[model samples]
Target: MTPTITTFTQQRVTVADGVALNVAVGGAGSPVVLLHGFPQTHLMWRHVATDLAADHTVICPDLRGYGDSDKPAATDGRTYAKRTMAADVVALARALGHDRFALAGHDRGALVAVRAGLDHPGAVTHLAALDVLPTLDMWEVMHGTSAAVGFHLYLMAQPPGLPERMIGASADAFFGHFLDGWATDPDAIPADVRAAYLKASREAVPSIVADYRASATVDVEDDQADRLAGHRLRMPVTVLQQDWGTALGFDAAARWRAWAPNLVHNTVSCGHFMAEEDPGEVVKALRGLLSR
Candidate 1:
């Protein structure tokens, strides 16, 4: 069966201090920004964006260094910090004439969403993070061989040049591995989407590695700052995670509660790509979170 996609065109918008980005905007009413995870683009949210667009304006963008967006050379200051990425979302929302918006992000996008909420608590109305814990917790919990689930976190967190070179060598294999491993069903991610993700990741290897490196370095600093300042998410927060805690032996909800004072967290019976693996359930969770 040929699927029909609500064809949206590309529009370039500048953010991250003049780093131009390609964004896909559609629908009307209250604005909701959907951020896609690593090794993928805004296309990851194609199904959810269309469904939410029925009643609320949906703005999905190929985040900087991915998809149709500008792939700037990430340097000392211009690297892919979630803080900078979150700021890009702020600039994107403001450009779209939304002073306050609801945000939902999956996988790596969820990392950025949490940063956005903590940084711009006034601008983000509600926040939902799918399938990830905060960077600090994620790093601290990994040890010896037990942390094999996030092998890339340590690999990409290395000195910038090595990860970029290695990943670039076989970008297709690296990106395709996640698409294949995370999804419960092979058909969940169509071949075209898989191809697009691989192409984008290959093109954005430097920035992607920089993003992960930041997670291990500057991102950790930012999270530590928030922790020291006792900064908690002011907006209502929701977290939908696979039962990694049960599998890995950590209280997922308890960890989230430590950071978010106002929180509703749940574990879903799905794999890592919760949205793609279980779109209907993801939508229901979003509807409930946003409704609150």
Candidate 2:
């Protein structure tokens, strides 16, 4: 089905120094920022954003170099570090007149959301992370065969020019693989949505690769340092993940408890794309977290 271009509040944000991001806003009241996952855009929150917007202002932004945002050049030592990217969200919310907000992110966005809660404990009143572990734990849990599940982790983690060049060669297929592999139900992601995801990802290949590259290098180290220092998530936190007991090895929520103190974890019966496959469940889980 084609998107009818419904009633969405849209704008662009020049956040964190000067990076511009395309943002969609709606609803009114307390603010809640929805951050989409990798290989997807802010549109991923179509099901949940408007509902939350009814009770709280909802802000959705295409991260730095993704979606219709500016594709700025990645300077040496200034690539897409999660910390820097996380700052963009804070700035995005501020750009929309929100100094504090509830924040929820899915998959890659979950990583960013976790970082935001850690980096800006005061600004984020409540936190929700969907379908991901902390970056440090993600890398630490990797083993022989377990590593195979995320080939792109190594691929995109490659040094500088290599990953970008190879990914560019077949950008469509590269992004499509994750789009296809992650969703348990195709209807969960309609065709137009799929097309938008593929289109946004294809155009943002270089920055997307840079984002992943930073995650493997700087992002992982940063999360590790925070963990070593025993800095847990201070805000109310909700984590939604696949049980992963049979597929990945351990319980997903159990691993997350190591980092989040005020935490509630729900193992949903869905694939990694939990938000897309079951947005209502995601919304319910988030409401529960925010209420606490």
Candidate 3:
């Protein structure tokens, strides 16, 4: 059987235009909304969520295009844009009686969290992004041979149909490749959890591809506009990442500092799935962020 966060109640909450998200809510006190990354679901927070729930109200939701949430069709460029997804997160929190909350996300979800912090600064009191650079900086820094590490980004950024079909044809192999390769500790994701992630990704190829496609197009445009307007994250921000900048040839903290003046950037000693591979460290970083 697949595992879930302990002591959390699962529910389906409608966030936008009849689109509902499958979410897990637990604990009391202050509210914190946690978003999961690509090739995975809210289940990625199984350890971290339970730990935080000891004192805070934790909201863990499957992003619209992944897991059990409503997968709306990507009718236009805006459909799966981070702006639209960020609105879904704000709506999810408000529906759960939180006008303002702390927010954290990993991988693709980190992209969404950054958008939420930028677009709804008043709504997100504290922000944490684990293992991802902002969209605009990500596109700017990835160059030449180093770009090969992110081949999936380029693959899914193609013009819709072909990318979707190609990934769909051999979904498990494609998704499992990341699951196998990106982790320094393979045992961090147990066999059943790995299976669950593969199943979710396999079933949501088109929507998943649409999410990445938007990152390449609409998300970049949105970030660029924000940059040109000199907008920055107002809340305190925490960024935990592996030392990818050393290999990618760009100062990760410097790039993040451009958008987040109030930032605490740390290079974690783990893989991309740090929340799973090293949940204790992730929880520690998050707890420190919440206190700030």
lDDT of 1 by residue, 118-202 (tens): 9899999999999999998888777756799789988998875788889889999998999999887888788887887888888
Candidate 1, residue 276: the lDDT equals 78
After superposition, which runs of candidate 2 have C-alpha atoms over 4 Å from their true positions? 1-5
> How well is each residue in 1-292 modelled by candidate 2, as lDDT tens digits?
1131247767777896567888888878888999999888888898888777778888888888788877777785456888888898998888889899999998888888888989998899999998888888888777788789889999988877888889889988988898888888878888888898888888888889888888888898888899889998988999888766457676667678888878898788888777778889988998888898
Cα-lDDT of candidate 2 = 0.83
Give the TM-score of each candidate. Answer: 0.95, 0.95, 0.98
Give lDDT tens digits, candidate 3, residues 31-61: 9899999789999999999899899999999
**On TM-score, who's better, 2 or 3?**
3
Model 1 collision count: 0
Q: What are the lDDT scores of the predictions, listed in order?
A: 0.84, 0.83, 0.93
TM-score of 1: 0.95
True lDDT of residue 289, candidate 2: 82
lDDT, residue 183, model 1: 80
Which pairs, if any, clash in model 3? none
